[model samples]
Target chain A: MKSQRVAVLILAGLFLYLSLYTWNLRTGHLDALSNHTGLEVSSWVLRPGKWVADRATTLWKRYVFLVGLQRENERLKDEIGRLVLENADLHERDRTVNRLERLLSFDPPVHWTRKGGRVVAQRLGPAAALETVLVDQGDLSGIRPDTPVITPDGVVGRVMRVGLTASTVLLLTDPNSAIPVISQTTRTPGVAFGRGPGRDMVVEYMNVNAGLKAGEELVTSGLAGIFPKGLPVAVISSVERSDLSLFLSVHATPLIDAALLEEVLFLARTRAGEGH
Target chain B: MLGPSWWLLYTFVGVWAQHFFPGMDFLAPGLLVSLQEERRGNIIWLTVSWILLQEGMGSLFFGSTLLWYGCLILAFHLGRGLFSSTSVTLMCLLGAFLGALHFLFTLMIMRLEVMAFPFERVLFEAVLQAALTPILWWVAHQLYPRRLRSDERSV
Candidate 1:
């Protein structure tokens, strides 16, 4: 009799909780409950764990893992020394090449101020939300919305939202993302828009008559005023023309895999009027 | 006297585990507490505290943890008829099931909220969480052997 009474009371409580939760969900007021207190409390709780983990990692690296790492570090140091010597040789060669280019009156590439930032957080929303990543740089770091983010390989994304100490980057694979691009081979202009994460972006607004081929390189057109001109964006994967449509359907894979990126360079374009 | 200390320790471990391994259900300790305590008030308090912790740590909806605990409680009650409450294997299996259920439930809620679901990544996380829960339960049992024992004891 007592057990049955307890069961009934638990059920009643469950029903009441569900009703309130559903009401909050519909009204979108549930987010109001997700204040900074929860974040702070969670951070405090996790800090000790993180500290323990760090200590464990340090102990492992210093005591257990040092033998192999020492050899690898020595090898890496030798390789770096060799690379430094090679870099000096290359610098001299570059100076000669630049002198020849100046004599030939060739135009140099556009220069932009670059800042490096670390990826602090990723996919800050629910499962079905936009593909976004947060960096450790913000307004204090001169990071603003629409600033083009890149890696050594190619274009990564652009800053979408800025906070005090962090900024959110909208990856190129996000559905809402669109960038002006040009094919290197055919010199055809088009707009590349993301299909979704893990999918190739579709290049639209290209003339049906435009001769585009597979394996052609795609670069930023600088028409959008966000990404600088001639930055490598993607390599053209395929191109198709439909009899029913006026625009050619082209697909290109992004050069940067945003999921694998740990660090990125933010390109803040200096206006012509501003002295560098 | 020791109850609050145990709660604090478990809560700290749960939050830490969740930080290192996202999508892992750190609330398994709370479930063990609820089952062991059996009192309605104790269960309610444990569930509420866990819900708050999960909501604060997770980037999901506000009541997601509440809904998850509700489902877990129902499952525990249903499983009580089939398996002994003291069985470690039963607890492990329940943890695995709850892990998968958590992924599916969160996915459904995200769909309702009109969010884009990354199916492959979420599924992978669900599988990982399911696999890890049993191991985590084993660790929890080792740490709180007396509390997790099936023998009747006063609070």
Candidate 2:
């Protein structure tokens, strides 16, 4: 009688669980509930913890790591002086480009606003099965899902999910991440698919005859409607002719290391005619 | 009051640990501790809270965590019939089982959701989960307030 009771309980529980799972799958109400509540509370906890850690490290570095501060300041000053000169030259070129575009009656370029955010955590807990990082900006900060995240060096990833005060970024090296890219010089287009973390992404569907070469840069082609055009994505590492397939077998290294990212710039597209 | 406070503190620290040690579940040991205390209310509360937190934080579907904790509860019940509930050996075995379960469950869930997953990394996390679960259980068990011990309650 006792054994029968346990068996019956197990069957009943399994039935109930399956029903809940199926219902939740059909309607994402449970997912949203968890995201809003659990994800929010987690961000609340992490933000303060990260802030304290950053403050402590900053305090120590400012007070104790002063051996070459004077020398670094002098070096930066010289670089800034050179940059100011370069900026003036670039401004002149920009004015000429605007004049040429107006004369040709070209469409206004799309403007992307850059908002900075700090990395709060990476792949937290068992549920963080993907290669991802949590950032300190979210829906409230104008970051929606699929917002392109990049650093000065290159593309980072895009916002995968957003809470009110935080968001999860799917890194470029995650298996699920794919981007449409074109070779910088050859103008050859292909889809770059991430293999996994710590592995180079593979570029697929490029014609075997395309003139892609090792060490060539790949930039976003803006075909996906997520990432903007001409943003640097990766550098080609290898290219080979596959006998069985019509496309070239190619791999490229992402310019930015996801693990080393401490900050990122979220790019929000707006109408260029609206004026910044 | 004390029980809720303790769990709150554990959850905070667990989140920090989870951040540092990505892809690992640090709060899993707490469930066992709750089970041993025979606190039915706390067990239900912890399971629901953890499931919500994990589902929100994780990239997988919401039900993965529900199945994970459900498996744990079932395992505990089954294991209790054979061995002492607090036995170190039993804890180690349960940990290993959970480790394997983590890998299998993740793969199955990811596939069902049509998401690509890093099998190699998940496997590594599984091994780490097996090794750490027992140790974490020991630490959590030791830290349990004596006043809150189930044995201390006068029936």
Candidate 3:
């Protein structure tokens, strides 16, 4: 009994030391080690479960979910047709603006190398750490690292890491993540930063007098050219004065569900000449 | 068959289950603690499997689950004398409290790296834990009836 007690005490000490060490670990050592091990071992083990989950999702999509989606699609098609006819006049105006921009010496940003993919699975919460989506596109689809991903609505994030068959999106909401942004109405510029633990998008370092208002829409300021400029980032949710600094404390909710997005566009735009 | 140690065994099982399906939020570990009074061989096996699973998951820190489970089990083993498992209701409450304890501990440890502390997230997790712990405790109790009786044979 005495020896057992002593052994338990020793074990306890070792664990405490280990926990303390890991608890304070800021580097990526642990994550890397896990990945190396998990890659080699758990993939085979988890294959069955992943397969089942994938099949279930696929079956649901093809059967029970598709009929309603088809009906919804048809309805939307009708609505779209009606709207397109109604908006013919607006399209003419848009053409005029495009012509005027060309005539007035403005260069419109172009979309190039647009690759499409379906989101296969969402990485488990903090489970994936970086807001990453496992898309079914890879080298075959020409998806590459640093590709800007977007939805029909707005910018999602960028492709950070890619596997042969899958790629991980480094979400704009990751703490280490940032996007160049500008106010659509006034061209006020700032950097959009992720509020970690999945909070709203926030922009920082704008001058206190920058005239930011609640509900003002923020777009990807083309200043960086990394993003094709003018992608909607978020709307100003809150703006307040800081006690210690001249910069205002500002918050904006992201336009896209970084976690729930299932389809995205990968812009294979090279980081050629863009810094914001 | 393992008798009184079944809860401990299932806790280990929870860890193993995490290998297949990610995101139980240490529910397996917490359930293991409430399942029995102490750790045992099966419990150790369960923990190891989970550590391997989490390691394999490619997204978590190496040995994160091992460090967490090992530390908590050691602590709980020493501290078990302070709590009574007189009944299943009490056992569940104990289990839930422990589950909550683990969540708080993790948050404290991870807060430094945390840039955004969304309150909704914390609240959601807490509520999920509270709701799930008793269910897990009940299931564990069923698996190891002796833990509920508290007078069964050791093995």
For each candidate, the alpha-carbon lDDT, in order, equals 0.69, 0.85, 0.59
Which 10-residue span in candidate 3 chain A carries the lowest summed lDDT?
Answer: A38-47
Q: Residues A1-276, candidate 2: write the lDDT tens digits.
A: 999998999899989988887898899788778877778788888988888996787566444434434456777855764565457557856975664444334221368777778888888888788888988898789888899888767889998878888888999888889999999999999999888877899999988999889999999998988888888899999999977899999999999888888767888878662343
Worst 10 residues of 1 chain B by lDDT: B146-155
Worst lDDT window (10 residues) for model 2 chain A? A100-109
Model 2: which docking level applies?
A: medium
Query: How many clashing pairs per prediction, in order?
Result: 3, 1, 4
Instruction: Tell me the spans in candidate 2 whose CA falls farther than 4 Å from its real position.
Output: A59-111, A271-276
Best by DockQ: 2
Q: Which ten residues in a row have the lowest lDDT in candidate 1 chain A?
A: A100-109
How well is each residue in A1-276 modelled by candidate 1, as lDDT tens digits?
977997898899878877876887687455444423343455445445546876787565445433544566687856764565467558867975664444334222366677777665455312214567656676678888798888766788898655445566888887667899999888999998877767899999988999888899899998988888888888889999899998899999999888777667888766761342
Winner on lDDT (2 vs 3): 2
- Residue by residue across B1-155, what tens digits does model 1's lDDT show? 56667767787766665544545676664576456554677677777766665564455457766767777777777777788765777777777787687678777777766655666667777787667766776676666647534454653
* Residue pairs with clashing backbones, model 1: A128-B115, A128-B116, A128-B117
Best by lDDT: 2
Candidate 1 ranges with C-alpha deviation above 4 Å: A1-28, A42-236, A242-250, A259-276, B1-5, B37-46, B145-155
Model 2 error, position B132 (Å): 0.5
Residue B152 shift from truth in candidate 2, angstroms:
1.4
Residue A112 of candidate 3: its Cα lDDT?
Answer: 48
Q: Give the alpha carbon lDDT tens digit for every residue of A1-276 in model 3.
A: 977986998788777756745653666455444444433343333345567876777565445434544566687856765565447647756975664443334223464446666665554322333445556665557776677887656778887655445555767876656898888776678888887535787788767878888999888876655677777888889999877897888898888876566567777653553322
